[model samples]
Target: MAMKRNGKSPVSSDTDEKFMFFKDVSLGPHETQLRFRLIHFWEARNPVKKTIIGLEMLLIDEQGTVIQGFIPPGRIKKYLPDLKQGSVYRLNNFYGSKNKPMYRVADHIATVSFTWNSELSVLHEIPTCFDEDRFRFHSYEDFEANCDIKGDLYDVVGHMKLVNGHTLIERPTPDEVKIDTTRHIMVHVQSHDGPVMKLYLWDQAAADFCKKFNSYDNTPTLLLVTAVNTKRLGGTLALTSMSPSRIISTGSAQTRRLLIKQVSADVVTKPWYYIGCSGCHAKATKGATSLVCTNTKCEKINTAGVPQYRAKISVYDNSDQAVFVLLGDAGRVLTGRHASELVSSYFEANGSEGADHLVPVPEALISTIGQTHKFCVKVTQHNFSGDTRAITVTKILSLDTPSPTEASVGNDIAAMSEGATQSGDAVCEPHKGGGVTADEESKRACSSADPETAKRPRCEN
Candidate 1:
């Protein structure tokens, strides 16, 4: 028992003594990494009379260096710890620099994130495991039935115009303006199991088109997609993300139940987007199409042209049981702002709509992109010696509907920017006495030129 002096208890005001560890601590140094945990601390009054702080330390990998440090008042004890006295920890990091030592942390005990020298490459020596009772999948064919994914799907054989040669860069006369491309012909595919898959295509027109942009050597590229701003072309589409769709892939017998965790990170996703045109309209249906026209009817067939369309793929490992890392960009498509703008302009210019089809290309494509959901995916990374490394992917999965945009008849992506300006509950903007016309504003809106009665999807392509 301590005696009271001058109205206060005679306890020591030493924070270090009171914060002494009470349980055993452990620290393991792997590669250059040091993983440790603080069990507990206590303050004991020794027989000699003065206060002594007792810290139970385990100091893992006794030979490896352990980080010894101190904590100040209002900084040491703040919340519950994830680790207990006998708890174990495994951190894939390095022994930090003493010169640039770590700072004193308040709620560091319960923090889920840890700092490292740089982006560390995690070694996956063992295969991930899963219950195999969850997840689902849909091939390019099913994507076809639901989406406008074109190609000789059932033939098991098709071609993807990698690069187009006959791109009309020169200002077209009334002649050049008429012949241009605007539709995308996606070669449907089948979903299979494995650690790796190949998605390459071949096309004559695309290959010849690619040759024009080649250096003096006349060497053509198998996947050299360049973006150029043209009056009539399409924008590019990257696989911003790849989560397992409705279903997940598991071991042969357990395909029904989605293995959410393992496959989650295996998919791919990108934050920003780079647009580019895919292709041009074929012969036959040109003059009949009209969306934002002056006297209304302005349609004519343009020549054949296919713009550069990028590729994005996501792989999955249904063996693991977590999905936090699955939503991310798969670097499958090209990443140049020039390429992005080129693609965006294509969809903006050549793309038009008929009362039947309703939507136009390039610009219409942006609207389509806006309507689609955003997702994430992970890939298999290969780690080498501390000096170097490499990585490759094998499977792919599209996870659940993680994030989808809200769309309504009056409120669409085209109007999203305008919607934010008006009062939250305010009435719609009234056209200045007259309805919307071509010269009034740039590009066009979903409600542009008055809603011309709902109609069927015109078979323009």
Candidate 2:
């Protein structure tokens, strides 16, 4: 006979079967009953094969002990229809199997696997309370200790210092195109007074972060990520999101700006711009009849090509010196002229040229030398890999106020004057007649003929 608890039918106390806690579960078939709350569940898939391995879950008992649970692909249909995130459930028969060591989300020695005859039912009346959720947060030092170990995955909470090198409050433009094909975002976060650590969010985690970040009127500074894997990149500890990872943001926005003074342009070594796919803004290759995007993930097979700025310049500040690559919108923010407009103006006046036509460094970019300005830069895997010494600048900040690019659309003249502070140097627009002056044409002709410059790999987006 079942007993009533708080006006609801409770598990029958008169039953001969005894209920066991998660801690008591051992490796073998368990005929006894186990009660737990389903904290969360996600599909586990084989990365290489792209096949579903099983449905993985986190379960918590009345004792607040959390354990990993799994339902084989064959039995998923039996239990998935009734599975709810926070619902309390009872399992009659389950197999106790050893938990996999790699990418373990919960600190459990064994996993509860559903058997062919296993029965899952909702608990109408819970006898005891179960914790709603559980989290294991690790400090920077703790993560550093276990870096690249593939041990127990943990959670992290901190104040976001940078998102793709932009401040926490900075938002991307509606039409902004990202060159990174992976769509991953890198964030610098610091917990308390600890050192700053890099967190890379990929795929769904990146989408969730952007959704939560933009939902608020003011940007959220505090960040919390669950089940993150730690890896050492360039000998520095970095945290990365896993398939089961979750992102949470709260608290007020914090701004930390990075400013630098333009020392010189490196146009002698690298071209100032690249032809990119109009669809995805990735570098485009010359196709049989048309240009094609180099990004394998791009949907467009044949796409129109457009010239985009990718200027490399040496920059210095009171602290140190570094090379920064001004790409796409960042170049427009500094020069007040789009790369397409400049390329078109040059070609229209000089006549159509070959694919290797080297557009001279625009006077607009050269005019910014010795000027100090704040910049938004992205730190990519290339930076960690030491493949490139230049950091990609995403946006340029004004000296007096935030650029209209960050606020709303405004007058181009006003935005350029405020956004890019010129050192009393005259800003020269692209020459509409013959593309270049005698002096500038001489410089371009010499650079174009140089075997070394021609041998240097073209700058990729």
Overall lDDT per candidate, in order of appearance: 0.23, 0.66
Worst 10 residues of 1 by lDDT: 239-248
Summed backbone clashes in each candidate are 88, 0
Clashes of 2: 0
> What's the CA error at residue 389 for candidate 1, in Å?
28
Off by over 4 Å in 1: 1-154, 160-335, 338-343, 351-461
Those runs of model 2 whose alpha carbons end farther than 4 Å from true positions after fitting are: 1-17, 169-181, 249-461
Residue range 1-461, candidate 1, lDDT tens digits: 33222222222223311111112122321132223343222222243765443221222222232233222223223212333442333343222222211111121122222233212222233122212111113333332342222211111111111222221122111111212242221211113211111222223222222233232132221121111111111221111101101111112123212322323333323212212112211111224442222212223223222222222222222121111111011222212223335444645664663323211113222222111123222112212222112111111123452333233423543544442322101112322333322211211111131111212111100
Each candidate: RMSD: 26.3, 22.3
The TM-scores, one per candidate, come to: 0.14, 0.51
Which clashing pairs does model 2 show?
none
